[model samples]
Target: MAHEGKADEQLFQLLANLLHQVESLTNQEEVELRTKIEALGLEVTKVPSKSLKQLDELEIAKELDKLSEKLDNVDEMISSAMAADPQVQSLLSDTADIWMPVITASADERRNFTPSVGENSETEANCES
Candidate 1:
């Protein structure tokens, strides 16, 4: 049981490391995409200012809506790029392969682990007999 627990911990760590790598890769890709967009003369404002009190409510709302649309466009561009990038697709496939087995094993373990409710009851009953 102790060994099994250790193995599970190791698997969890591996999964966490893989996920972190994927996240880092995604952030890098997004930065690259933003750079490309900026290169094409579109201003990529990543951090929108929250100080909209100076503007009227309608103006603030309009600004927010505009920012949302810009973000959506950026996302669409990134999605299209990812779809065309074979390396990104391969990395995603490899990650899925590594992730699936661990997840399936965890689910199977959870399903199989049933606690015995009256495990000691039988011994006590035999002693009484």
Candidate 2:
């Protein structure tokens, strides 16, 4: 169906944009944090600590592994819960089917939601000005 295709396209774009925006914001935050760290005189090379560890590639890989393990635990918990209760399983299934569209719709709604546009005449006048 054309409607389903359009919805799928919107969902895909939403996910892609989300990933891009998150990465961009995360990079900005990393830059700010690094600046703060440098200001604090805690540069990795300057700091003298016996237990100091640089976040190198291997460390990042290990962290990724831990993240994967945590996700697996989450999946296991979900599967276990679904197995324990048919009603939960059904509800989850329904949520998966219904919430996807609701998520897109709610996102659109929030994006359109405006402030300083109520029935208050003074507030509307200030906003317009």
Candidate 3:
């Protein structure tokens, strides 16, 4: 039971870490992209995940999921935003190649991740009991 809670906590921490990484790349790299992302309403930070309640964990999970959907459609968003505003098109053209790939790769890695063998075994044992 405790392990399950720990696992949930770990999942929340991982989601928050992803959020922080996105912020770090966008925050320092391109203000334009940052502006686009900030409009999505993510409030994640460097909070210590261990101290948060389970409900907070659920909220973080939902927010991260929401952010992922928008991120997955980034190219389309860029295209539409660029079409709508010529100024942003020029700005995006300058830096879109710089940090977007890193963010995408990070998201891919997160999506394709498999839990460690030990973690799976532990979870299985917990379930069997």
Go through the candidates in order and give the C-alpha RMSD of each one to the true structure: 18.2, 18.4, 14.9
Q: Which lDDT tens digits does candidate 3 get at residues 87-125?
A: 556545544443344244453453444456885566445
Residue range 23-128, candidate 1, lDDT tens digits: 5755553556444534433232123469846898899799889978976885687477559776556654654543345345654554454324473354234323
User: Could you tell me the lDDT of residue 91 within candidate 1?
Assistant: 51
The regions of model 3 sitting more than 4 angstroms off are 1-44, 51-65, 70-77, 107-129
Ranking by lDDT: 3, 1, 2
Sort the predicted structures by TM-score, highest score first.
2, 1, 3
Q: What range of 10 consecutive residues in model 2 has the weakest lDDT sum?
A: 36-45
Model with the higher lDDT, candidate 2 or 3: 3
Backbone clashes for every candidate come to 0, 0, 0
Clashing pairs in 3: none
lDDT of 2 by residue, 15-125 (tens): 333334433644533344334334423321243447576788998899889867965864786698579657547545643533344344544553443323242354224
Error of 2 at 88 (Å): 0.9
The 0-to-1 C-alpha lDDT of every candidate, in the order given, reads 0.50, 0.46, 0.50
Model 2 error, position 103 (Å): 12
